[model samples]
Target: MSEASLLKTQVVTLRVPNELKSRLEQQAKSQGVSLNNLANYLLTTQLSQLETLSGIEQRLRGRNLNDLKQKIAFLLNKVPHNPDLPEWDRL
Candidate 1:
Protein backbone atom coordinates (compact mmCIF):
# COMPACT_ATOMS: atom_id res chain seq x y z
CA MET A 1 0.00 0.00 0.00
CA SER A 2 2.92 2.35 -0.52
CA GLU A 3 2.54 5.52 -2.69
CA ALA A 4 4.89 4.06 -5.32
CA SER A 5 2.85 0.86 -5.54
CA LEU A 6 -0.36 2.83 -5.93
CA LEU A 7 1.11 4.89 -8.77
CA LYS A 8 2.65 1.97 -10.63
CA THR A 9 1.00 0.39 -13.67
CA GLN A 10 1.71 -3.27 -14.35
CA VAL A 11 1.20 -4.95 -17.71
CA VAL A 12 -1.47 -7.64 -17.79
CA THR A 13 -1.75 -10.44 -20.40
CA LEU A 14 -5.15 -11.95 -20.97
CA ARG A 15 -5.90 -15.09 -22.97
CA VAL A 16 -9.01 -13.95 -24.80
CA PRO A 17 -10.73 -15.93 -27.53
CA ASN A 18 -9.55 -15.10 -31.05
CA GLU A 19 -13.01 -14.02 -32.29
CA LEU A 20 -13.53 -11.62 -29.40
CA LYS A 21 -10.08 -10.11 -29.87
CA SER A 22 -10.75 -9.63 -33.56
CA ARG A 23 -14.05 -7.89 -32.87
CA LEU A 24 -12.47 -5.61 -30.28
CA GLU A 25 -9.70 -4.73 -32.68
CA GLN A 26 -12.20 -3.98 -35.44
CA GLN A 27 -14.28 -1.75 -33.15
CA ALA A 28 -11.18 0.12 -31.98
CA LYS A 29 -10.10 0.64 -35.59
CA SER A 30 -13.54 1.97 -36.55
CA GLN A 31 -13.47 4.38 -33.60
CA GLY A 32 -9.93 5.54 -34.55
CA VAL A 33 -8.58 4.54 -31.13
CA SER A 34 -5.80 2.19 -30.14
CA LEU A 35 -6.89 -1.30 -29.07
CA ASN A 36 -5.22 -0.72 -25.70
CA ASN A 37 -7.22 2.48 -25.20
CA LEU A 38 -10.44 0.71 -26.13
CA ALA A 39 -9.72 -2.11 -23.70
CA ASN A 40 -8.85 0.39 -20.96
CA TYR A 41 -12.12 2.21 -21.56
CA LEU A 42 -14.11 -1.03 -21.30
CA LEU A 43 -12.31 -2.24 -18.15
CA THR A 44 -12.58 1.14 -16.38
CA THR A 45 -16.28 1.58 -17.17
CA GLN A 46 -17.10 -2.01 -16.16
CA LEU A 47 -15.50 -1.37 -12.76
CA SER A 48 -17.42 1.91 -12.52
CA GLN A 49 -20.67 0.01 -13.16
CA LEU A 50 -19.88 -2.41 -10.32
CA GLU A 51 -19.09 0.53 -8.04
CA THR A 52 -22.47 2.10 -8.85
CA LEU A 53 -24.29 -1.20 -8.24
CA SER A 54 -22.49 -1.61 -4.90
CA GLY A 55 -23.54 1.90 -3.89
CA ILE A 56 -27.19 1.10 -4.72
CA GLU A 57 -27.07 -2.17 -2.73
CA GLN A 58 -25.53 -0.38 0.24
CA ARG A 59 -28.25 2.29 0.19
CA LEU A 60 -31.11 -0.24 0.02
CA ARG A 61 -29.68 -2.80 2.49
CA GLY A 62 -32.01 -1.83 5.33
CA ARG A 63 -35.16 -1.36 3.22
CA ASN A 64 -38.16 -3.59 3.93
CA LEU A 65 -39.53 -5.35 0.86
CA ASN A 66 -43.09 -5.71 2.17
CA ASP A 67 -43.21 -2.07 3.21
CA LEU A 68 -41.99 -1.05 -0.23
CA LYS A 69 -44.62 -3.22 -1.90
CA GLN A 70 -47.40 -1.74 0.22
CA LYS A 71 -46.19 1.78 -0.45
CA ILE A 72 -46.10 1.10 -4.19
CA ALA A 73 -49.61 -0.38 -4.13
CA PHE A 74 -50.94 2.60 -2.22
CA LEU A 75 -49.34 5.03 -4.67
CA LEU A 76 -50.65 3.09 -7.67
CA ASN A 77 -54.19 3.07 -6.30
CA LYS A 78 -54.05 6.81 -5.65
CA VAL A 79 -53.30 7.60 -9.28
CA PRO A 80 -56.49 8.57 -11.11
CA HIS A 81 -57.17 6.45 -14.18
CA ASN A 82 -57.41 8.29 -17.45
CA PRO A 83 -60.84 8.03 -19.01
CA ASP A 84 -59.21 7.36 -22.38
CA LEU A 85 -57.20 4.47 -20.93
CA PRO A 86 -59.81 2.41 -19.05
CA GLU A 87 -57.39 -0.58 -19.27
CA TRP A 88 -55.45 0.90 -16.36
CA ASP A 89 -58.39 0.11 -14.08
CA ARG A 90 -58.25 -3.57 -15.03
CA LEU A 91 -54.50 -3.67 -14.46
Candidate 2:
Protein backbone atom coordinates (compact mmCIF):
# COMPACT_ATOMS: atom_id res chain seq x y z
CA MET A 1 0.00 0.00 0.00
CA SER A 2 1.12 3.56 -0.63
CA GLU A 3 1.95 5.88 2.23
CA ALA A 4 -1.12 7.95 1.52
CA SER A 5 -3.33 4.90 1.86
CA LEU A 6 -1.59 4.11 5.13
CA LEU A 7 -2.47 7.47 6.63
CA LYS A 8 -4.71 7.44 9.69
CA THR A 9 -8.42 7.99 9.25
CA GLN A 10 -11.09 9.09 11.70
CA VAL A 11 -14.53 7.60 12.09
CA VAL A 12 -17.49 9.78 11.08
CA THR A 13 -21.13 9.29 11.90
CA LEU A 14 -23.96 10.00 9.50
CA ARG A 15 -27.69 9.59 9.98
CA VAL A 16 -28.75 8.56 6.48
CA PRO A 17 -32.27 7.39 5.74
CA ASN A 18 -32.76 3.61 5.87
CA GLU A 19 -33.37 3.36 2.14
CA LEU A 20 -30.27 5.31 1.28
CA LYS A 21 -28.19 3.25 3.69
CA SER A 22 -29.54 0.01 2.22
CA ARG A 23 -28.77 1.19 -1.30
CA LEU A 24 -25.27 2.15 -0.34
CA GLU A 25 -24.73 -1.21 1.35
CA GLN A 26 -25.95 -3.03 -1.74
CA GLN A 27 -23.67 -1.00 -3.99
CA ALA A 28 -20.69 -1.61 -1.73
CA LYS A 29 -21.32 -5.37 -1.77
CA SER A 30 -21.71 -5.39 -5.54
CA GLN A 31 -18.45 -3.52 -5.98
CA GLY A 32 -16.56 -5.91 -3.64
CA VAL A 33 -15.59 -3.13 -1.27
CA SER A 34 -16.62 -2.52 2.31
CA LEU A 35 -19.35 0.06 2.98
CA ASN A 36 -16.76 2.35 4.49
CA ASN A 37 -14.58 2.21 1.37
CA LEU A 38 -17.51 2.86 -0.93
CA ALA A 39 -18.74 5.76 1.16
CA ASN A 40 -15.25 7.30 1.32
CA TYR A 41 -14.77 6.93 -2.44
CA LEU A 42 -18.15 8.43 -3.25
CA LEU A 43 -17.71 11.40 -0.94
CA THR A 44 -14.18 12.20 -2.13
CA THR A 45 -14.81 11.75 -5.86
CA GLN A 46 -18.17 13.53 -5.95
CA LEU A 47 -16.79 16.55 -4.16
CA SER A 48 -13.87 16.81 -6.58
CA GLN A 49 -16.18 16.43 -9.58
CA LEU A 50 -18.53 19.10 -8.24
CA GLU A 51 -15.61 21.48 -7.75
CA THR A 52 -14.34 20.77 -11.30
CA LEU A 53 -17.75 21.40 -12.86
CA SER A 54 -18.10 24.65 -10.93
CA GLY A 55 -14.83 25.94 -12.39
CA ILE A 56 -15.73 24.70 -15.86
CA GLU A 57 -19.14 26.39 -15.62
CA GLN A 58 -17.54 29.73 -14.76
CA ARG A 59 -15.02 29.41 -17.59
CA LEU A 60 -17.58 28.37 -20.21
CA ARG A 61 -20.48 30.47 -19.00
CA GLY A 62 -20.74 32.28 -22.35
CA ARG A 63 -19.05 29.72 -24.56
CA ASN A 64 -20.56 27.96 -27.57
CA LEU A 65 -21.00 24.23 -28.24
CA ASN A 66 -17.75 24.07 -30.20
CA ASP A 67 -15.87 25.54 -27.25
CA LEU A 68 -17.44 22.97 -24.91
CA LYS A 69 -16.58 20.14 -27.30
CA GLN A 70 -12.97 21.31 -27.54
CA LYS A 71 -12.64 21.53 -23.78
CA ILE A 72 -14.14 18.05 -23.38
CA ALA A 73 -11.88 16.59 -26.05
CA PHE A 74 -8.84 18.18 -24.41
CA LEU A 75 -9.77 16.72 -21.04
CA LEU A 76 -10.54 13.30 -22.53
CA ASN A 77 -7.20 13.23 -24.30
CA LYS A 78 -5.42 13.49 -20.97
CA VAL A 79 -6.51 9.97 -20.06
CA PRO A 80 -4.35 7.05 -21.15
CA HIS A 81 -6.06 4.50 -23.40
CA ASN A 82 -4.90 1.48 -21.46
CA PRO A 83 -7.13 -1.62 -21.26
CA ASP A 84 -5.22 -3.41 -18.54
CA LEU A 85 -6.58 -3.17 -15.01
CA PRO A 86 -4.83 -4.27 -11.89
CA GLU A 87 -6.49 -7.14 -10.03
CA TRP A 88 -7.48 -4.86 -7.17
CA ASP A 89 -9.22 -2.45 -9.56
CA ARG A 90 -10.94 -5.08 -11.70
CA LEU A 91 -14.67 -5.39 -11.19
Candidate 3:
Protein backbone atom coordinates (compact mmCIF):
# COMPACT_ATOMS: atom_id res chain seq x y z
CA MET A 1 0.00 0.00 0.00
CA SER A 2 1.19 3.48 -0.86
CA GLU A 3 1.04 6.45 1.49
CA ALA A 4 -1.05 8.24 -1.09
CA SER A 5 -3.67 5.50 -0.85
CA LEU A 6 -3.76 5.69 2.93
CA LEU A 7 -6.57 7.47 4.66
CA LYS A 8 -5.63 10.60 6.55
CA THR A 9 -7.67 12.16 9.31
CA GLN A 10 -10.74 13.91 7.96
CA VAL A 11 -13.66 15.35 9.85
CA VAL A 12 -17.22 14.38 9.02
CA THR A 13 -20.55 15.10 10.68
CA LEU A 14 -22.78 12.29 11.90
CA ARG A 15 -26.23 12.31 13.46
CA VAL A 16 -27.19 9.52 15.78
CA PRO A 17 -30.17 8.97 18.00
CA ASN A 18 -29.74 10.94 21.21
CA GLU A 19 -29.90 7.83 23.39
CA LEU A 20 -27.34 5.98 21.29
CA LYS A 21 -25.00 8.95 21.28
CA SER A 22 -25.26 9.25 25.05
CA ARG A 23 -24.58 5.55 25.48
CA LEU A 24 -21.47 5.74 23.30
CA GLU A 25 -20.20 8.73 25.24
CA GLN A 26 -20.77 6.98 28.53
CA GLN A 27 -19.04 3.80 27.32
CA ALA A 28 -16.07 5.78 26.06
CA LYS A 29 -15.76 7.61 29.36
CA SER A 30 -15.87 4.35 31.29
CA GLN A 31 -13.16 2.87 29.06
CA GLY A 32 -11.06 6.08 29.41
CA VAL A 33 -10.99 6.45 25.63
CA SER A 34 -12.41 9.16 23.43
CA LEU A 35 -15.58 8.26 21.54
CA ASN A 36 -13.76 8.56 18.21
CA ASN A 37 -10.95 6.29 19.36
CA LEU A 38 -13.36 3.67 20.69
CA ALA A 39 -15.33 3.64 17.45
CA ASN A 40 -12.13 3.34 15.39
CA TYR A 41 -10.94 0.46 17.56
CA LEU A 42 -14.22 -1.42 17.16
CA LEU A 43 -14.21 -0.98 13.37
CA THR A 44 -10.59 -2.10 13.06
CA THR A 45 -11.24 -5.20 15.17
CA GLN A 46 -14.28 -6.15 13.06
CA LEU A 47 -12.34 -5.68 9.83
CA SER A 48 -9.56 -7.94 11.09
CA GLN A 49 -12.13 -10.62 12.03
CA LEU A 50 -13.67 -10.44 8.55
CA GLU A 51 -10.26 -10.94 6.93
CA THR A 52 -9.59 -13.95 9.15
CA LEU A 53 -12.97 -15.47 8.30
CA SER A 54 -12.35 -15.01 4.57
CA GLY A 55 -9.10 -16.96 4.78
CA ILE A 56 -10.83 -19.76 6.73
CA GLU A 57 -13.60 -20.00 4.13
CA GLN A 58 -11.10 -20.31 1.28
CA ARG A 59 -9.35 -23.17 3.09
CA LEU A 60 -12.65 -24.99 3.77
CA ARG A 61 -13.70 -24.73 0.11
CA GLY A 62 -10.41 -26.28 -1.03
CA ARG A 63 -10.81 -29.11 1.49
CA ASN A 64 -14.39 -29.75 0.38
CA LEU A 65 -13.37 -30.03 -3.28
CA ASN A 66 -10.59 -32.46 -2.42
CA ASP A 67 -12.97 -34.63 -0.34
CA LEU A 68 -15.51 -34.75 -3.18
CA LYS A 69 -12.88 -35.94 -5.63
CA GLN A 70 -11.71 -38.66 -3.25
CA LYS A 71 -15.31 -39.87 -2.75
CA ILE A 72 -15.91 -40.09 -6.50
CA ALA A 73 -12.72 -42.11 -6.98
CA PHE A 74 -13.70 -44.49 -4.17
CA LEU A 75 -17.19 -45.05 -5.65
CA LEU A 76 -15.74 -45.74 -9.07
CA ASN A 77 -13.46 -48.41 -7.57
CA LYS A 78 -16.46 -50.21 -5.98
CA VAL A 79 -18.52 -50.51 -9.22
CA PRO A 80 -19.20 -54.12 -10.40
CA HIS A 81 -17.32 -55.15 -13.57
CA ASN A 82 -19.76 -57.91 -14.53
CA PRO A 83 -23.53 -58.25 -14.04
CA ASP A 84 -24.96 -61.40 -12.39
CA LEU A 85 -28.15 -61.43 -14.51
CA PRO A 86 -28.16 -62.63 -18.11
CA GLU A 87 -28.99 -60.13 -20.85
CA TRP A 88 -32.75 -60.36 -21.56
CA ASP A 89 -32.41 -58.74 -24.97
CA ARG A 90 -30.06 -61.52 -26.19
CA LEU A 91 -32.52 -64.33 -25.16
Find the candidate with the highest lDDT and give its number. 1
Clashing pairs in 3: none
Taking the tens digit of each residue's C-alpha lDDT, what string does model 1 give over 31-65? Answer: 99999989999999999999999999998799998
**What does the lDDT read for residue 36 in candidate 2?**
94
* Per-residue alpha-carbon lDDT of candidate 3 for residues 8-89, written as tens digits (9 for 90 to 100): 7778688889998899899999999999998788779999999999998977774778787899899988876666657873
**TM-score for candidate 1:** 0.64
Number of the top candidate by TM-score?
1
Superposed by TM-score, candidate 2 places the C-alpha of residue 90 at a distance from the truth, in angstroms, of: 30
Quantify how close model 2 is to the true structure by its C-alpha RMSD in Å: 9.1
As for TM-score, the candidate ahead, 1 or 2, is 1
Model 2 quality (TM-score): 0.56
In order of TM-score, best first, we have 1, 2, 3
Question: Model 3 Cα RMSD, Å?
Answer: 16.4
Query: Which sections of candidate 2 miss by over 4 Å?
Result: 1-6, 61-91
Clash count, candidate 2: 0
